[model samples]
Target: MRSGFDCASFRVRCLHADRGGRLSAVERQVERLPEELVNKIQAGEVVERPASVVKELVENALDAGARSVHVDIEGGGAGLVRVRDDGRGMSRADTELALERHATSKLRTLDDLQAIATHGFRGEALPSIAAVSELVLRTREGETEAGTEIAVSHGRRLHLRDVGHPRGTTVEVRDLFGAVPARRKFLRAASTEAGHVAEAVTLLSLARPQTGFFLRSGGRRLIEAPPADGLAARLFQLFGDRLLEDLVPVEGGADWAAVRGFVSRPDRPRPSRPSLRLFVNRRPVRDRALAKAVSQAFRAVGGGDRGFEAFLFVEVPPHVVDVNVHPAKTEVRFADGRTVWAAVERAVRQALGEGVRELPRVEVAAGRGEATGVAGRAAAAVGTFLDRGSGEASGSEIEWGGAAGPPDRVAEAEGAAPGVEAPVPVILGQHRLTYIVASDGDELVLVDQHTAHERVRFERLLDRAGRHAVRSQGLITPLVLELPPELRPVLADHGETLRELGFDVEGFGGGSTRLSAVPAILGQKDPGPALERILRDLADREEAGWAVAGTRDRLAATLACHSAVRAGQALNRESMSAIVRDLLQTAHPTLCPHGRPTVVRVPREEVSRWFGRTGWRRS
Candidate 1:
């Protein structure tokens, strides 16, 4: 059967007959939707959640030249949300038009879109918000005698009237997404949603230091930041003096594009990259290229493996950067992204150069605590052994028990065949208590004591874990750690994996965890720092979509790093010899698990060339 539908009246009718003389149904596949339906569709994109609503409203306030903004929320902003700002308010006519789609004073024409100086220019915030919630907007321009109040529900005007109000704007929203039950059902728990709202406000607060921001949830103040003198003061106000002292100032760039802000010192690394905040032209954003630039700069200074906390600001002409790329405006497209990346990298490198302290030098003393020449100082610094019979200084060679025995059982477990022997380097004196000086007949070898042991321990630990033989050391009293809400989910997801690696952890209500035991390999070392590092590594790997085997390897590597000997700790001859022997027995003798060189070999010919004896024969 064939039938036709009237587009105007949406009524079904039999229109024509088919080839078989039977009527068929025919309907218009495409038609322009009504304005109300259009607004509801736009709301799907502009208002993702309560946090999205908060972001749009706050951004509008900032664009209005507001010096102070306050936000209050209830039921994670799904029940009610109120934002008040002290700034230039709109008049009665403008206030009424503000609720209309595509009605904005910030954008005059297409050319204005290319150079957007304001936080909002699309003018879809008010209308989109009003489409899904009950909203009340009140405003009073400075010259006006009375303010205008408008009430709207689900994109329909309910009432409008004149009222007395301050010379600013206040917007109250209630029953967010009430008309759209599907969207409301997707919202998380109140606490989780509130955390997202807080994060959104925090980013905006950091972006604008001269403006004061206050946030309250369930009638309790969450964030209260007053106007700050500068970025440093703002950082101190938000994160306190400890973070302020850990950061180094960065300032440099060309006139076309400039960069400035603060980067964390090498020693103060955070577990994740969220601690690094980025802003362009006073707008907070998340850009992978800019973040990669910062990471590359920190990697040069021996950091960035774990993340670093930084607050970087980039200033470029509006025409060169497009902030309209994302509807939420959290992403940007640069005209010349490489140039901006280089500018950021160079500025951070310069700052690190000035902020990082010089490496410590080992001081040497002469005979009986008396000062000596360079040779005596060098010998003493390397801990030269004295001859027992004559009481005279021996050569650099340190006496070991004997040549290394057969391959270690850990190596055998790691795929090494039985009865296999690995060549061991002759143990020489230490170098600055960091490197282990050794000789392999034709080459002078230098081993990083820390990484050497790290490799050895890593292999052993992996072997034990594979065999389910990991040893645990129980604590006399359980240790309690208060974790952030974000980390609690990570802990819950990976709690089993943690226990498999010799960590006995259990949740103790209120976003805290109880630690009952740790890997015995940690020994007397404080397990707090190591446990935290492991948890962070697990979280990062899980987010990166690592396989189960890869996650296990990462956990073992983290445990090995904590149990290994420190760089500055003094090691005796036996300790050094054992590390060298075990390091060679491992499958990979040249590099550590983290890809750092465990041993560096300088050929005899290279040393001879340095001494200008490459081709000399007793001449």
Candidate 2:
């Protein structure tokens, strides 16, 4: 009995040694992750959110030559996302291969990567999306009589069957990131996600104006844009015709490249740039170099502070621009960035010179909708957010919506007409000769003289821009000035724009130009210093590799700055009243051309609270 027990103990020790050997092996060795796990890890990079999934599927449809594409989303695309397209679909075998990583027919050789024209060449989008969601693909190829339908969930194929379908494709994704709940927690609220999805669709539709696009949420159609011939027509369809007054068409080309797009004029500015789009080879991309060039061109014209919007389309040889910079394919690197920058800058300059006229405002169909789907999301994101700088009004004759007026309204209410204009404030006096102090019975307003005048002049310039009728003051003695050789091109390129701004410049041989006239708004001030500053601005711009184009707005601002009523200049009450009237008439009365607040209002109640004479709310 004792020997039997000893043998049993020996066997137990042997078993423990064997287990230890196995553990040692495991600790020393490294094994590749399972295929499913590897695919899921790859999916983490590509399928970031519902919007990323939407962007990929839409691009795939577009690459397939879809004439009309439709997107449907629910729960901000977390619950379900379906994309339908009338494009050339794939066969059963190709559809099966599409679920696998790195399986794509878009590229063949190394050279194909350099000149990628298709929106999606990496086959990663499909496999990555399928790895993390329940994906269903229904496709009917042109050669096949029946359609092929495949179901995949979490990188596993559930079924592949023949189904009846039209000659197109449909992709549906359900419960995105369901297999990985950790990723799902990172998603934003439904409305914010919907906004991002809507923005993606808007940008894609803008890039492909020839293709029709429709987006819906919860079975309600939000966007329905038909195929259009030009960018203007497409923009009109997406944003409505209010943009007709804002957009300036810019077109320019050189030997190797061409650029054509629309830029907003200086007067029409936004706080954020939601609509600024840039495309290369018909693919939408966010290239900083191109955007910087465009911004610099606009700034050269004093439209920098207002925050401009533009849709710039650059056409270059596909090989010259690399579209494979990022996995999402939203960025591109140009081969010769200087050439592209020069082209874009020149185009904007020419377009600025040819002033944009406000076309008849047409009703925007997208604007008429509740805040639910694509229309609402896109419109809300891009609509004018009336952010009054400093959150105060400038001029005294302004209406403060429905809640502003005298506290004792009954006294002034007798026999007053309902539509009567708000009474212009009485000018109390000037503060330090820089600010105009005015009282409207409730509050005292302080207006910055320089900023106020700048705003007034900018509006006048915009109004005259359409008519090309800026009054000119002919120089009593024609100022013939010798300019540096570098500034000669600035004169030649912007000659017409300068003339329209009331500068009559004639160039002569050997770096000499004669200035016969200047803007009448300059009054008795010397034009010599202003002109020199403008030349210096142009020269500095050129030195920075930006085109010295689109300087009309800048020149106007320069002229206004130099000619505005100086501080300490004593003005009579009539002049102050006239200034106040003009100030109220200007659009964007709160901010100057440079985006600084022109006025600060101090309420009488606030002053009383500050003196501790009455109870006040502590902040």
Candidate 3:
């Protein structure tokens, strides 16, 4: 036993000595990396993927004062990326220096960094990109008879020569990350990478509407925008007239900081916050506070919990905003974030208020031949009824089959237990063709007609969907829709779900779709608007990380909202009565599918107290 223990101890000591000797042999030192390695490392930071390469090249073209820019990509920008721009080109000397790290003409001193007006001030784009791929740059100035052509391979200059070229710059990058297998391996599928590249180009095009931008991938033209007159024209060109009509112009701010752009109407909200695009000094950025402010402003003016779409541009002194916070330059830090937030909020609020005022008012025919605004007429009728101390009216009166009751009549009257069904109330009339004014014995109940109908439709749709019994209604004349290219794939992906919901949709080619049928519940209503809303919702759901069940539920709710009666539509007594009856029969009568209140009850005592008649009752 003693000999065995001694042998084990000796082996352990030998192992420790071996480790110490190995540690002592290795030197602890630091040294600068070689130029090639340095460039490759920089590329890792600036060029995350093919999309990053496209972004840097495009920004450079725009910064060069390019009036027109054309981009072509192959293999989702992995095999080749070429950007040709009609911008100021570089001389032979400048072209050679452009491939070197930390070489830029946009900045001279440290102060210049504080007020960067150009997008390529960092000067790291060229060298960093050249480090990981084969690059060829051909540039010619207006004064030069011949252009300079420089070829580089993995941070090494291969050749420089004079060639005949136009007065612009063309950068062709091939085999991106060819030398860095690690990065190349991390790239996603070709289609996904192509999507990212398209998004980058779209953002840049949106920022510079005055410049013509064209993009082609795999020999297919993806985006083509001519020089637009302004932002509105650009929007119309990109998204078509349907989306443009839904946006209202927003303009306001102080001299120090100003904001201008377009915001979606409160009634036409999007499904996700990413729809809100924000730009600071004509540069797209992601700022949470600014985005939140826009949402808050929308909510302040009756835009509910749903997401909103906005294109807001904030202009401030360049020094007041820091664009160097990230290597990608997609985020900005403001000097006075609070002030900026307040300005955006105020501007959006004012624009929404003005938009609401400019909207066409609903007119209702009164006694004789006179016509008055819905709100004015509704108020006058309510006042007259109160002064006369009566709950009865003649024309337009909708009778209830059961005893009068509120949304929670049993609880309010007899203090009954929860879950007891409320009696159907008498539908007195409609207020502004929106709310159903009802009399629940001694209470005045206001029911949102749209929401009430929406609830009924939602419950029915849910039941039908669960049982896989949704009915379809064919149309005589098919509807054709023009959608953005990126959204076309969404339809194909959710084609099964849409068909289950009673829509017969098929691609009509080139960003157009044909709708041959729709859900029978929609009746004669125009499905164009509703279809657009559903498409947008589905697109948002793709990135929302929701389960399949949640997505189906959302689809059902959206269908119900579009199928139900609109707020401004005039409803007859039968329609009003049907809505009230259907709503009461629903499992959740008090709330809509989106969880908004469907009915609001003003107790008899509360109304009487306002008129100093609480202590008196009819004898």
Top model number, TM-score: 3
1-619: candidate 2 lDDT, tens digit per residue: 2232223324333433454444343221112234553343222256788989999999989988999899988877888889999899987667766666655667655577788778876666887787778899999988689999988776666777899888889999999888677889888655445555766787889888899988876654456678988788887766556555567787896657799988876445332332368888888888777777776776565443334578888899988988776768888888898998888877876676565233122223443323234543343233222111111222111111111111122113112324535566788866544577887778877887657766676667756866887778788888766542224445555677778888878775434578888776654244543464455454333323321124576656544544444333333344555456567666677877556777788998877678775644435
**Global fold similarity of model 2 (TM-score):** 0.55
Candidate 1 runs further than 4 Å off: 1-44, 272-274, 357-619
Across 375-460, the per-residue lDDT of candidate 3 in tens digits comes to 33343333222211121111111111012122222122212224746676887877754678888787898988767877877887
Per-candidate Cα RMSD to the true structure, in Å, reads 14.1, 21.7, 13.9
- Comparing 1 and 2 on TM-score, the stronger one: 1
Candidate 1: the clashing residue pairs are 1-23, 1-24, 2-23, 2-24, 2-25, 3-24, 3-25, 3-26
TM-scores for all candidates: the values are 0.57, 0.55, 0.61
Q: Give all candidates' CA lDDT scores.
A: 0.68, 0.64, 0.69
Residue 523 Cα positional deviation in candidate 2, in Å, after optimal superposition: 36
